[model samples]
Target chain A: MKRGWIIGGAAVIVAVFAWLLFGGLQKNVVFFLTPKELLAKGTDGVGVPVRLGGQVKPGSVKWNAQTLDLRFIVTDGAREVPVHSTGAPPQMFRDGMGVVVEGRFGTAGVFEATGLMVKHSNEYRPPKPGEEAHEKYKTLIQQSSQ
Target chain B: MKPEGQLNSSSDRLRDPSAARPPRTSIWLAFVSIGAVIVAQTYAILTSPAEGDMGHLQKIMYVHVPAAWMTFLSFFVVFAFSVRYLWQRRENDDLLAASAAEVGATFNGLTLMLGMIWGRPAWGVWWVWDARLTSTLVLFLIFVGYLALRAFTDDTQQKARWSAAVGAIGALNVPIVYMSVKWWRTLHQPPSSPATLDPRYTMGLRLNAIALLLVMIYFIRKRYEIARLERATEHMAEAAAMGGK
Candidate 1:
C-alpha cells in the first residue's frame, strides 16, 4: 500500500508537470495584426520593435547588388508604405507576397526592416478561371445577408 | 512493507553474482529535488524581471530552457548506466539505463515541441534545419531508437548488452548537440544560461534550471523503480511456469 501510494503520487506529480510543460507552456501567445493595425499605430520611428505586415507592392522593389541593400514598398489596399532592408534575402523572399518585417519606421517615414519574415498564406494559389478570392468573398456576403 | 516474497527477492533476481547492491538514496534525493524545481520554476516565471526586448513572452524561456537542460542531464545518466552495464554486465544497471533512455526521449521530444512553439513567433518559422535544432532532432531520434530496441527485445541478457552498446554510441551526440550552435552558424541562439546570456534572465534561468533538473531526476527514478517491479513480476511468472513443468 505504501509503495502504491508512492507510485501513485509520483505519477500524479509527473502528470501535473507534463500538463504544465506541454499544455500551458507549449501554447504560444500570438498577436497577429493586419496592415490597417500597422497604419493606425502611426508610422513615426519610435525605436520599438513592431511588425509591419502586408503584401510587397507590385513593381516597387529595387535591389542594390553592390551593398546588398534592398528597397521595396508594402501595401494594405488602403495605403502604401516604403521599406528598406540590408541582408541576404531569404530563399522565399519575393514580390506581391505577404511579409511581416520586424522593426520600426525610419526617421524619413519609411518602414525600416531590421528583420524580414515571409508569410505564406494558405489562400494564395495560381489564378483559376472565375476562382478569384474576391468572388468567394462576394458569394459568402450574398449568401449571409439572405 | 516487509520483504516477504521469496521468488521476487533481490538475490534470486540477479543472474550474476556481483550484481547485488541496494538502490541508491540519490534516487530519492532526485525525486525531492524535482518537486523543489517545479516550485522554483513557477516562481521565477511569475516574479522574475521581464526581458527588456521580449516582454512576457520571455517567461516561456523558463520552461523551455529547463526541459532542454534536463534532456541533456538524463542522457548523461543513460550514458553512465550504459557504460556500467557494458563493463559489469548487470541486469539492474541495464534496466536503469533503459528507463533513463525512455524518460530522456520523452523530455527531448517535449523540448523540440516546445522549441518549435517558441520559435514560430520569435523566429517566424515553425522549424528550420539549423545546427542546434537539427542536432537535437538527431538526439531525440537516437533515444527513440533506444526505446524501440528495448520494446522488441524480450531476452533480458541480449537486450541489456545490445542496448548498452547502442546507448553508449548514442550518448556521444549529446555534447555535439550542445556545441552545434557554437560550431555552426545557426538561427537558433546558443546557451541562454551560465553562458553569454542577458544579465536579467541569467539568475532566473539558473534557478528554474535547477528546479527542472530535480523534477527530471525524480521522474526518471520513478520510471526505473516501476521497471524493476515489472522485471520482478516477470521473474516470478517465469519461476512459477518452471515449477509447474
Candidate 2:
C-alpha cells in the first residue's frame, strides 16, 4: 500500500510538470519569421510579437540624428519590409548587415521594431564583398552621432 | 592504506569503512587531472578559429560548452545514485549522490558565468528571460536547493531519503533546460557545434570535455572519501562516549 502511494504521487507530479512545461511554452514563445513569411500572414501576423530576421537593404537606411528617427528596409532574398525605429541603432548596425528585430507589424505596412539587435559574430568584419561602403552613413551618422 | 589499486578502490571503503587514508594513486590522479585541464584549456584557446562574426570571442565556446556538458553529467550522477540509494538503502550510494550534487553545482556556476561573458558580446545583452537562460538558472537553483536541504537535515537516513527525492525530481529540469532553446523562440543561439552536426569547434570542445570529466570524477571521489571518513569518525565517537559512561 505504501509503495502504491509513492508511485501514484510520482505520477501525479510528473503529469503536472508536463502540463506546465507545454502550457508555458505555448504562451511565451514568439515566432521567428522572415519578412516574406510575415507578410504572408496578413492580418494574423499584424500586432503580434515576433522576431523578424533579415538583412538591412543597402541604400534604404535613412536617419535624422536630431529627431532620433532611424528608418531602414529589411530584406530576405526577394521581399523587403520597411522598418522604423526611434533610437540610435547599435554601433555595428550597417547596411547589408544581418539583423533580428523584435516587435510587431503595424497596420501601415511597417515593422515597428522596439528592440533592434545587430547580428554579429566575433570576427565578422564590417567590410564584405558586395556591401555598400560604410562611408555612405557619414552624413546621417554625424547628424545622429551616438 | 591498501596496496596498488587503493586510491579510488571504492569497494575498499565499502569493505573497510574505517580506512581514512586514501591510496597514493588517487592523490596523483587529482594532480594529473588538474594538469591535463590546464593544458587542454591552453590548446583550446590557442587553436580556436575566429567565427566570421564572433571573432576570437567564439573561443569561449570551448569552456562554455564543456561546462554545460559537465553540469548535465554531474546531475545525471546525482539522479542515478539517488535512485540506487533509495532502492538499496545504502549510505555509500547517498554519499556519492551528495558528492555529485556539489561537483555539479560548481560546474553549473561555471556554465552560467561563461554564458554571461559570451552573451554580452554575441547576444548584445547581459541577460534575458528567454526559456534557455531561465531554465538553466532554475536547474542551478534546484541543485543548490538539494545541497541546502541535505545540510539542514540531522539524521543520516532521513537526509538521504529527502535528498534522493529532491535530486531525482530536480533532474527533470536538465532535459527541459537543454530543450528550451529548441522548444521556445529563444534569444540564445541554437547548438552550432554539436559533435556530429558541425566540426567547427569539435577538437577543442571534445578535448576539454574529456579533461573536465576527469576533473569532475576526481572531485567526487575525493569528496566521497571525506564523507566516509566523517561517518567513521562519528561512529567511533559515539562508541567512545557510551564506553566512558
Candidate 3:
C-alpha cells in the first residue's frame, strides 16, 4: 500500500510540473509572421525581435570582402526592407531564397539584422526526421534511455 | 542487500502499498498550487515591459528561464533520490528518483524547444554547436536514454537498479552542461544569475521562477502518487487472484 502511494504521488508531481511550466497561454508565444504581417506592422523603432520571413531580393545583395559586411534587401513581394549584417553568413542565405533575420529596425526603418538563419524548402523523413543537426539530441536520448 | 536473482520478486512488488491510507488532499493542493503559478507566469509574460531592443521577443525570457530552471531542478531531484535509492535500497527512494528523472526529461525537452524558437530570431540559427547548447543537448539525450532503459527492462528489480545507476551517473552532466558556456568558446550567452538582472526585471523573473519551482514540485509529487496508485491496483488484482487460487 505504501509503495503504491509513492508511485501515484510521483505521477501527480510530474503532471503538475508540466502544467505549471507550459499550461499558461502567454501572448508572447512566438509565431512565424508572414511578409505581409511584417510590413503591416511597420518597424518604427519598436525593437520587437522579429523573424522577418521573406525572399532575398535578387539584385540587392552586395558584399564587401574587406569588412565582411553583407548588405541585402528582404522583400515581401510588395515592400522591401534593407538588411545590413556583419557576420559569417549561413550557407543557405542566398538571393531570392526564403530567410529569417533576427534584429530590430534601424532608425531609417531598414531591418538591420543581428542574426541570420536559413530555411530549407525540402521536407524531412523519419529515420532522418529532417534536421541534420539533431543528431546530438538523438544520441543523448539513446544513452540516457538505455 | 539481496542477491541479483532475488531482486526479481522485490521489484515485482515494488508498488505494494505500505500506506494504510493515501493522502488525497495533498494531490489537490498540488494541483491548485500549479494552477496559481501558471496564472502568475502568464501575467508576467504578457504584461511585462517590452525591451528597448528585442521588443516582444523579450517576453520569451519568461518561458525560457522557467523551463531551464525546471530542467535543472528536476535533474537535481533525480540525482539526490537516485543516490539514496542505491545506497539505502529504499523502494520509495527508487520510485522518487525514477519519477523525477521522467519529469526532468520532459522539462528539459521543453527548454530545448523554447530555446529553438527563441533562437531562430535571436541567434539567426535554429541550432548551434555552442558549448552550452551542446551540453544541454547531451543532458536531454541522457534522460531519454534513461527512460528507454526503464522501458526495455522487464524485471522490476533489475530495471530499478539499472535505472538508479543511470540516474546517478547521468546527473554528473548537469553541472558540466551549465558550465559549458564558460568552458568552451561558444555562441550561446551565459546566464545572468539572480544577482545580475535590473531590480524590477529581476524581481519579476525571480517571482516567476519561484512560482515555476513550486509548480514543478507539485507535478513531481502528483506523478509519484499516480504511479503508486497504479501499482496498488495491480497488486490488489494479483492478491485477489491468488486468494481465488
Highest lDDT against the true fold, candidate: 2
Task: Point out where model 1 deviates above 4 Å.
Answer: A1-146, B1-35, B193-198
lDDT-wise, the better of 1 and 2 is 2
lDDT per residue for candidate 2 within B1-245, as digits (tens), equals 33343333444444573554433237787888898889888887776555445456667777888889899999999999998887898888898899899999999999999998877756556676667888899999999999999889989889998899889878878888887777776667666544332354567778888999899889888888788678767655654464445
Tell me the chain A TM-score of model 2. Answer: 0.67
Error of 2 at B179 (Å): 1.9
Against the true structure, what is model 3's DockQ? 0.04
| Model 1 Cα shift for residue B156 (angstroms) | 1.1
Q: After superposition, how far is residue B194 of candidate 2 from its true place, in Å?
A: 5.8
lDDT at B144 for candidate 1?
Answer: 88
Residue A138 in model 1: lDDT: 33
Q: Which stretches of candidate 2 lie above 4 Å from their native place?
A: A20-24, A31-69, A74-80, A86-99, A103-107, A118-146, B1-25, B194-200
Kindly list the per-residue Cα lDDT of model 2 for residues A10-83, writing each as its tens digit. 78879887886777656656435788889998899999997787889998988878898889999988788999
Model 1 sits at an interface RMSD, in angstroms, of 17.6
Q: Note the clash tally of each candidate.
A: 3, 11, 49
Lowest lDDT sum, 10 consecutive residues, model 2 chain B, at B1-10
**CA lDDT of every candidate:** 0.69, 0.77, 0.67
Please give the TM-score that candidate 2 achieves against the real structure.
Answer: 0.78
Q: TM-score per model for chain B alone?
A: 0.85, 0.87, 0.85
